[model samples]
Target chain A: NAGVTQTPKFRVLKTGQSMTLLCAQDMNHEYMYWYRQDPGMGLRLIHYSVGEGTTAKGEVPDGYNVSRLKKQNFLLGLESAAPSQTSVYFCASSSRWREGVNEQFFGPGTRLTVL
Target chain B: AQSVAQPEDQVNVAEGNPLTVKCTYSVSGNPYLFWYVQYPNRGLQFLLKYITGDNLVKGSYGFEAEFNKSQTSFHLKKPSALVSDSALYFCAVRESTSNTGKLIFGQGTTLQVKP
Candidate 1:
């Protein structure tokens, strides 16, 4: 199964331009997350969804929005891209927390560059 | 607030020598700690996790981590380092009380194994 897949492996956007990143997972996971990886800064959560139709802010949720309208898909949107937003974005999914599974599965990241 | 820290920005070791990557975390409750490795231009790969049971947890690619509650540290270690092990390592923690399964990541540590 394609554990997780991200659309547009690489993208370049101009300041003020907007775009949405799509993440799809076939593992039927109940939890999905969006994170940005900057050099040396590791991966910081931008947003996450516990289940369908639910979303919550994360450590660095500013300048980003997310939607989980379906059980298998999570989308991250940038309303107005900025140079500081340029980084490698990752999508991950995992089973429910109480099920004894705590490891998250990540997809190939999407590298974004905003000028 | 939950947080994780990787004290070293980079670690260098000779091939076939023992290697260690230090990590420490803070959380309101019990912490579910994890380690992930990322190759250049690739997504993060899960290495190991410490949830409960033995303090020494073994995981993928011959990596293991020791969870020290008193020290509040979970350091990744390998018996012998390989050149292929040169990559970026990250430590993360999730509070047991968090139903949302959110994780706080540390600034990554670069591991350089010289052949």
Candidate 2:
């Protein structure tokens, strides 16, 4: 299985440009998440979806929006990209939300450079 | 709020020697801890997790982690280090109180195994 896959491995955007990062999971997971990784900040959650048609803001969801139109797809959108938004974005999915037993599977990551 | 911390930025160990990457967490209720590994330019891979049963939990790539409830620690360990195991390790946790299903991650620790 492809597990979790992200579109556009790398992209460059000018200030104020908008784009969407697509995440697809074939594992039939019920929970999906979007996180941004900075040099020393580790991974910070931006938005998450518990199931299809359900989305919620996370720790760093201020400049981002997300939609889970289908169970296998979660899309992260940057309405007006800023230089501060330049970072590596990762998508992950999990089958459960109970506890340590539910391990998250991550995508290869999308490197975004907002110039 | 649930949070995780990885004290060391990097850990160096010789081949054939035991290695450890320390982690600590904070949560209101029962904590669910997890460890993940990331190779250069790749996505994070699941290692092991501590749910309920045993304090010591085994995971992929011959790695294990000890979960200490009193100390709120989950340290990743390996019996013998391998050069191939050199990578970035992350400690993560989720609070059992809320059902939002968001993960809190620590600043990653880079593991350097010298041959």
Candidate 3:
């Protein structure tokens, strides 16, 4: 089983462009999250979904939107991308809650470069 | 708010030698700590976690971490290093309350295992 998968491993976007990153998990997990990794910044939370049909803003949700319409899919969207938004984005899923439970399983990540 | 700190920017160890990656945390309530490894252009992989149990937690790929309450630290360790073990290591923490399953990550420590 492919635990977690992300589409469009690499992409380049111009300023003000919009794009979507897709994440899918076959493990029937209830929690999903989007995070961006930057140099010396660790991984910052962009968005998260506790369950299907419910999405919430995270620490760095300013330039992103998320939709969790299906149980297995969580999509992160960049509306008017900026150079600051150009980073490696990762999607993760966990069978249990992010706290006091199992660890999160991360996708292969998508590298986005905005110029 | 829960947060983590990876004090070092990188850690170097030779193959067949022991290695340690330091991590410390702060939280208002009970804290759930986690360790993840990321390779170049890849997603963060779950290495281990500390919920509520023994101070020592063992996880995948022969990696382990020690949770010290008084010190508020969860340091990752490996008895023997492998060249393939070279990667970026992150420490994360989540508070029990208000846990939308959101994780606060550290700045990350690059582990370089030389042969």
Query: lDDT per model, in order?
Result: 0.94, 0.93, 0.92
Error of 2 at B53 (Å): 1.3
Off by over 4 Å in 2: A98-100
The DockQ figures for the candidates are: 0.79, 0.74, 0.72
lDDT of 2 by residue, A11-115 (tens): 999999999999999998899999999988899999999999999988898989999999999999999999999999999999865533588999999999999
Candidate 1: misplaced stretches above 4 Å? none
lDDT tens per residue, model 3, B1-115: 5778999999999999999999999999999899999898888888888989799999999999999999999999999999999999999998877547788999999999999
Model 2 TM-score relative to the real fold: 0.97
Docking class of 3: medium
- Candidate 1 vs candidate 3: the TM-score winner is 1
Clashes of each: 0, 0, 0
The candidate, 2 or 3, that scores higher on DockQ is 2
lDDT of 2 at B21: 99
The TM-score obtained by model 1 is 0.98
lDDT of 2 by residue, B30-82 (tens): 99888999999999999988879899999999999999988989999999999
lDDT by residue (tens digit), candidate 1, A51-105:
9999999889999999999999999999999999999999999999888657899
lDDT accuracy of residue B15 in candidate 3: 100
lDDT of 2 at A17: 97
